[model samples]
Target chain A: MSYKAIQLIKRPSGDLTPDIFATVELPRPVLEEGQFLVRQTHMSLDPAMRTWLQEREDSYIEPVQVGEVMRSYGVGEVVESRNPDYPAGARVIGITGWAEYVLGNADMQVVDPAIDPEALLSVFYMTGLTAYVGLIRIGRPKAGETLVVSGAAGSVGSLVGQIAKAEGMRVVGIAGSDEKCRWLEEELGFDKAINYKSDNLGGQLDEACPNGIDLYYENTGGVIQPLVFERMNRFGRIVVCGMISEYNRDQPTPGPSWVDINLKALRVEGFVVVDHQDKAQEATEALAGYLQNGQLRFRTQVLEGLDSAIDGLSMLFRGDNTGKLLVRI
Target chain B: MSYKAIQLIKRPSGDLTPDIFATVELPRPVLEEGQFLVRQTHMSLDPAMRTWLQEREDSYIEPVQVGEVMRSYGVGEVVESRNPDYPAGARVIGITGWAEYVLGNADMQVVDPAIDPEALLSVFYMTGLTAYVGLIRIGRPKAGETLVVSGAAGSVGSLVGQIAKAEGMRVVGIAGSDEKCRWLEEELGFDKAINYKSDNLGGQLDEACPNGIDLYYENTGGVIQPLVFERMNRFGRIVVCGMISEYNRDQPTPGPSWVDINLKALRVEGFVVVDHQDKAQEATEALAGYLQNGQLRFRTQVLEGLDSAIDGLSMLFRGDNTGKLLVRI
Candidate 1:
């Protein structure tokens, strides 16, 4: 049997086009001993994927070698299993790829599908744990404190703002468009949402956070992140979850002078969810509680088929999507 | 009786010149209730002093206005005391100024000159506390780990190296000159010292820190700090005490991309010594024990008189001093 897969033929310089990858029919990967075959149904498109596709050195995960199937976190059904542990037709998620089927030996966790597919892939997979870890576990904004979240329209940023608001923090969000900003304030209960694309971002940010920022959830680093950094109160924490602004450029645009970090006494830290999977069970339970209580809300912008993954990713940079932008294959 | 004081006449654009300050002699203020008169003897010339003189809005301490006495950490002898809390002819240290005398009503701790003058001011005042808080209290390097320190020949950096050495960590120093590097390695028991002024800083840092940097005591920011930052291992901590390199610039120099901080999952934090003065007594007792045990050693570059304050501060950027650069009156 043969299956279609997106293979990385060449690395893009800045803007990624579909030509960088090619859809090819290949023999189905055979399951080895204690291995299973996953027929991937959906692939989570992320900003970090832009980093993975670039010609660069090693990151949190190994770089996808040329000629290899492109890397992605995928949700799929277990079609065949050589191991007694995973029976056939088991729904699971793991480090699959932009392929129709994945054959691997890594342990796959069964997805409950208690949440819908898009939410499961967006909230539970990459975005939820990211927000949970950075905002709750790391940033730890106290009650009545002013917390700022950048990329407010994005899946992770929205969740971060919602959770922080639920925890009694006065939450502010920075997004690219006024519409996105309104959604964040009205739908997600963000205290204020500043349009980063506007001319008076600095003025708006200052007005939004009069007492100065206590905790900054830095999702997109650019002019906006630096403006926020300057206003950070003493002992403020910067949970650097992503730098989506820099990911697509050949060279990242220079950020604001970090002299503020030194003079104001700030703590800037970065983390990834995959590295702290142990927090998965705890984060999931907490997030589930938020969902059940209606204190938490999420949105997903699903695109049709694996072919749309390339264009869906560009939405992140352009702020074209309102929430989790995913490719439903 | 009157004494001379250096007052900032104008805010500097970038580089500080002697023209910005004027030595004006004024009649001594009559001692008021609960006030003590301090005959300022020796003042600490620090990088942060540049920040205080800059045309900035605010920092850890309020910026020294253009016509005010230059803000500094000063040691002086109390010649007159009305409060009875401090006796006459008592030595004390406080946030005085670049002046011959300071009239204030704050609690003044009596100084015991058991240590030499410059060493006493350097090893026991703000410099000493800064090293202690950043290295021991914050960085918290465990045994057998490699600790890399930038500005390693300066007051705080040298102390950081010695303290880390005493803690049983392999210590590497980054200084501007070969002579300073030798002094750090030979006299202070640093495992290695990299000459940042040399062309091979990257190779030297790599050679010195073979296992990669576990903790980086960042006293100065610019070229040297970024080089050290590049070599830091995962989970490494950066103790940001000062950024002397950017202090004199109109627009602060941009450092390396923070993508490294994210990729390596590093913690880059900034702090001021004054904020943690409560740790002063505790740090003093511990540091005093190190000095007594000869596990800690220090050097001082002392200018002859108070007139030297203007030119004396230049020694920091030009790297003309070794341990503590002080103006001895």
Candidate 2:
């Protein structure tokens, strides 16, 4: 039997195109002793994937080496198992390379879809946790405090705003489109939604949060970042999750200088979800409760077939997606 | 009797010169109810004073207008008082402008030099308290951890190194000269010292801190900042006390386009000593004990004569002195 896979043939000079990824067929990976073979189901398409495509080093994960299958956290079903640790019918979540099938050690977790169907919280093992750890652990929002989340309609950003609100803090979302902003405010119950592309962020922030922001969840860093910093209250906490705005630009991103951070006495921190693996189970439990209770809602712009994975990933850099972009295989 | 004061004749256009201030004679201020008249004894010369003179919109304290006395924190002796709370002949510290005599509210603390004596800890009210709050409240260094302190031999920076050592952490100091570096390593018990002016910081940091830095006490910002960020350990904390490097620049400071802060998963926080006033007594007692036990030492670069206030303040921007720079009357 043969399997199809996406491989990074050459490092891209700047933007990722068709030439960078090669669709090829190979003999299905064979399972060795203490290993299970999984047929890929859904691959997570994240903005961070764009960072990996570039040859530069990021904070948490390493860049994808040429000739190697693109690195991604995927969900798959066990098709064959040489190890008794996983059964044939089990669904697992693990660090699997971007491919039609993954063969690896039985270290992956076999999930109970009954407990979390569609692996909504499991896929979160990456995006959900990124939001969870960045906000709860790093930002540390207190109840009744105002939390301003930029890119609040995207995967991690949406979850961040909702989770903060669930914790009894006021949540305001900033997005690019009117539709995304409306959905975030009406459906997600965000206290305010400011479309960054159309609105004067500084003015909107002042109007939305009259008192001033106590916690800032930054996902898109650029001009808006400086404005948010200017409006932060004394002793405000900031969690720098991503800079989706500058991801695609060939030139350098221009962010407001950090002078305000010093004078205003703000706490600005940057973190990757992978570093908080120790608290993954706990975060999953708490986030899952929100999902199960209907207090939290997640939207995935599903692109069917593995062929669209590249486009889905690109959309994140372009600020095109309304929620989590998932590639269904 | 009347005394001369250095008044803010004009807001500075970047670099401060002698022409920005004008000498003016005024009648001695009279004490009102709940207020005291203090005869200025010593004035603190800090780089932060530069920000106050720029007429900046982002400044926490209002910029001094034309014909106003230069704002500063000075130690003064109360010669007359109407408030029952504080009596005459008391030494107090507060936001008393740069004048020979000041009329201030009784809300400011009266420092009893007879009780505490002039020791290393006496400066704890300002410089030393800044170090304590930045380290304990912000950096949160643990035992066996390594701390890197920039501006390492200056007032607050020097105390931060010694305090980190007392907490059982390895301390590294970064200063402008070999003399200051020697003072940090030899006299202050710092594990290592890197003179940013001479040595290759990256290579030197590798040799000095083999395990990497866990806590960074950032007193200087500009070229030295990225170097420190590059070597920080995962989850490292940086307490930004001041950025003296950009204090005197005539142009807007250009920060690194790509801040590796995200990749390092570091925390950079800014704090003011005045905001941590709630812990003043606690920090004072602890620091005083260490000084009395001969475990802590402090240095002061006393620029003689009140007439030398302008020259003393200028030394901070030029990096001409070490420890706390003070103007004695």
Candidate 3:
């Protein structure tokens, strides 16, 4: 059997265009001992994808080289296996690259959804884990404290605000669109939402969080950060999950003078979720509980077909998507 | 008896002129029960004194009001006593206004000379405690880590760099003059010293601390800070002790950008020495041990008489003093 996949054919200059990626066909590898093949079901299209696409010097996790299969994390089902770790029929989650079928060693640990069928997608692994670690673990939101999450309506930031609200914190989200802002406050129970594009960001933020922000889950870093830094209270902590705002810019745009950081005494830490692998299971379990209890809700903007990965990723850079965008294969 | 005293007649505008302070005569304070009179011996002149002189809308502490006897920390010997806590002829170190004599409560703590005589003037209380707490307790310098101290030849910065070097970490010092920088490297055993006035600060910093700054003792703010922030390693801790460079400036100068903090992920905290009073005795004793063992040395530039207090303090603002500035009355 042969599998179709999207591969990186060219590196991008400023923004990712359709010509940057090329789709190709290849014969599927035969499963060896302790090896399995998986048919990709759902692949995450995150703002971080845009960062990886850039062939520049940044804090990105290495750029996608030309002629290589595009890298991604996906949920897939095992189609064939000659391994003891996974059977021929099982659902698994791992770094299944941008392809319809994936061949990997069975030793790559995966969660079997057979035992607990109701383990929702939000709890499956990465999505929920990113939310859990980014909030309770990194942000350390305390009850009655104010939490301002940028990109608040997106996958990681959305769950971050919801979890902060659950912790009894006053959650304020900043999204690009008025609709996303409304959804955050009205549906997600965020205390308030400020549309970063239309609203007076600094003024609205001050009004929304009168006590000053305690924890800032920073997913967007650019002009918004200076505004947030100015109003931060003493001992405020910022967790840098991603900086989607600076991904597509052509020139090196310097961030504004936030000298208020030293004046206010703030702790800003940058973290990647993959570094916290030890707590992956615990994070997934807790987030799943929230999902089952209907305490948390997220929207998945599903883009059909594996070929749409590039366009789906571009949605993040353009700030078009309202939630966790997934390319359904 | 009457004693001559200097009162803060007015807050100085841009510079400290003679009119800013007024010499006054006050009836010597009577020794009540549990109180003693001490003839002032030495007064410590600090940059914090000038900071207290400025009027701030949101002042951290109340500014020294007009017509008030200036507050200072001094060493004196009790001449008369009516209290059991302190006997006549005992040496004490405590808060004493800028006066020839002071009548203080018997509750005033006695300085233990034998514990370590170096501490009585150098290591026991303010400057010593500032260095001890700011370097050990606050900055938390580790072995093999690079520690950078701005204003390195000054009172607190000098001790911090020396202490960091003693802890097996490489130490770099940034002082105002070539003479001071040379003294820091030669007399204090600092690994590297750069004259902020003569050398390119950013270039010198990069060359001196090639591994990058892990712990920064931030004393000089404004232009120096942005340069320091750029070279700081990830998870670097910055202990904001004082901003002497910007303290005397009349206008509100802009500080470093939040991008410097956001990208590097630094922890910047400002701490008052009084807040860490609980550990003062322990830190003082340890620092005294190092002094007695010839592991630590404190340099002082002493000017004689109460009238020289203003001049001694002026040396701090001008960055003329190489070590702790003291007024020997």
Q: Best candidate, DockQ-wise?
A: 1
Tens digits of lDDT, candidate 3, A252-287: 455433333434445566666666679977986787
Model 1 agreement with the true structure over B169-255: per-residue lDDT tens digits: 999988888999899988888999888768877888888888888898887777777678778887888888888888887777766
In the order shown, the chain A TM-scores of the predictions are 0.95, 0.94, 0.92
lDDT of each: 0.83, 0.79, 0.77
Candidate with the larger lDDT of 1 and 3: 1
For the predicted complex of model 1, DockQ is: 0.57
Q: Write the per-residue lDDT of candidate 2 for residues B150-254, one digit (tens) a residue.
A: 888888888888888988999999999999989888998999999898757789988888898788888888677777776778778878899888777666465
Candidate 1 chain A worst ten-residue window by lDDT = A53-62
lDDT of 2 by residue, A1-329 (tens): 99888898987765557788887787986666777788878877777776776665334667888898887777888889887878887888878877889885544788775644245533358787888899988898899999999889988888899898889999989888899989998899999999887756778889999888999998888777777877888789888788776666667664445566678788888877677888888888888788877878877777788777767676876777767777778
Any residue pairs clashing in model 1, and if so which?
none
Could you tell which candidate, 2 or 3, scores higher by DockQ?
2
Q: On TM-score, who's better, 1 or 3?
A: 1
TM-score of each: 0.93, 0.90, 0.87
Model 2 DockQ class: medium
lDDT of 1 by residue, A189-215 (tens): 888998887897888888999899999
Q: What is the iRMS for every candidate structure?
A: 1.8, 2.7, 4.2
Q: Cα lDDT for residue A158, model 2? A: 89
- Per TM-score, the best of the predicted structures is 1
